[model samples]
Target: MEFTFLFSQFMSGLTYGLMLFLVASGLSLIFGVMNILNFAHATLWLIGAYICFTFWSLMEAHQFALWVSIPLAALATAATGWVCEVVLIKRIYKRELHEQLLITYAMALIFGDLIKIVWGPTDRLIVRPSIIQKPLFLFGAPIDSYFIFVILIGVAVAVGLWWFLKYTKYGHIVKAAVYSREMVGALGIPIPKIYTWVFTLGIFIAGLAGGVQSAIGSVTLGMDMNIIIQAFCVVVIGGFGSLMGTLVGSLIVGEVFSFAILYWPDGAMVLIFVITAMILIVKPWGLFGTPLRA
Candidate 1:
């Protein structure tokens, strides 16, 4: 019985960690390729959730509403990300770091307000499909069926991203840009266009994460604020631009938080910070990240 309980907790932590990976992977990719820190990333994610909810609500009578809405929300959010990159982010490429930070931070506030205007203050809930409505037993442990789906999606995404980064031409370009954007530009690659597509791809992943999250719980205002901080932590711990690092860091955080809550509920967050602090002290560049060029 005790083993079963522990297994369930471990599974829960894994689920949470993968969810963090989904959000943080895009964040890491953008920062790695463009050297841009996007404060509005989570807000865009929230928009994706709301968009999914709206789409699902429109076709609530159909059992297939949710399956269709998730991808649609992702595409819509990707479009928004593309526009923001071209209109606002493009102007800041050569600006000072402080200027870039200020712009992205302001965008976050603006996007947050836009969300309120469009979705109002009411919390939105997704009516899950009948297929995932019940619990599944695994070795005498009852697990949420939806969680199994979440786990599978997370694993699939992780594997898919790894394959893309390892085998594709654009992936090689992205990797090279990460090491030295100047070199990539010198090679005649359009840096600005690459930046735009990378940003859009990052936002698309975030949107997919958001759409998945909406089915997990009620989508409420200010949720982005919470997740964004954690997402940053994930990037920092995993090492910005290192996909495997992000995955490892996310699992560490998720597992620590899950188990810590059971033993020390009030200190779970503090414990996470403590661990993060330790990692930063030992390796400023993060566990998997290489030092930045001077």
Candidate 2:
């Protein structure tokens, strides 16, 4: 019984961590590559969740597969991200920091309202594929299949992202741009175009996370603000602009909440801050974060 409980907690923490990584990676990458701190990230997440629900419903009506809705949702949210960049974010590059903050906050409110208007003020549940409804056993310990599905998605996204950022030419360019956009621009690279692409990637990641996660529970109001705060916590604790840091931070925060709640349900969430403080005291920039440059 003890072993089963421990294993279950570990698996639960792992899935939660992976999902946090999916969300935090985008926040980190956007800051790393574009130097823009997006305030509407959670708004994007909620929108993606609704989009996922809508597409799945439409597809199910046509007798299509459930998994197809995930990509469609991702694509839709990615497109929305692009539109936002062109219409809103791009115009504010030279604005004051407070201006950016206000604009993003307003955008969040707008998106949040839009979600309520479309989906109504009720909880929505997604119908996952039939295969994921059962639990699987590994070494006599039963693990939920949906957890496995989420874990697989996390692994694939992590591996794919690593490969893209490490081996591809565009990846190197993104790195170079992150360090010094001026240098890249002087070398005849179009920085504006790169900015669009980077923002698109970040938003796409959030959408994918939302679509995958909505399968596990209800998609409802205030989810955007709730998860975004946690996502920001992951980014802040891990170090701004570091994907590896985001991953590590997500694991720390995720596990802290998962295991802590078992022992003290009311106090579990506070551990996230306590552990983050401990990490910050030792490595102020984060576990894998680089020191700031002039």
Best by lDDT: 1
> Would you estimate the TM-scores of all the predictions?
0.97, 0.96
lDDT of 1 by residue, 96-148 (tens): 88999999999999999999999999999998989988888999998888889
Candidate 1 lDDT (Cα, 0 to 1): 0.91
Compose the digit string of candidate 2's lDDT tens values, residues 187-229. Answer: 9988889899989998998899888877888898998876788
Global Cα RMSD, each model: 1.1, 1.5
* Cα lDDT listed for each candidate: 0.91, 0.85
Model 2 lDDT, residue 84, Cα: 94
Least lDDT summed over 10 consecutive residues: which range in candidate 2? 57-66
Please estimate how well model 2 matches the true structure, expressed as its whole-model Cα lDDT.
Answer: 0.85
Off by over 4 Å in 1: none
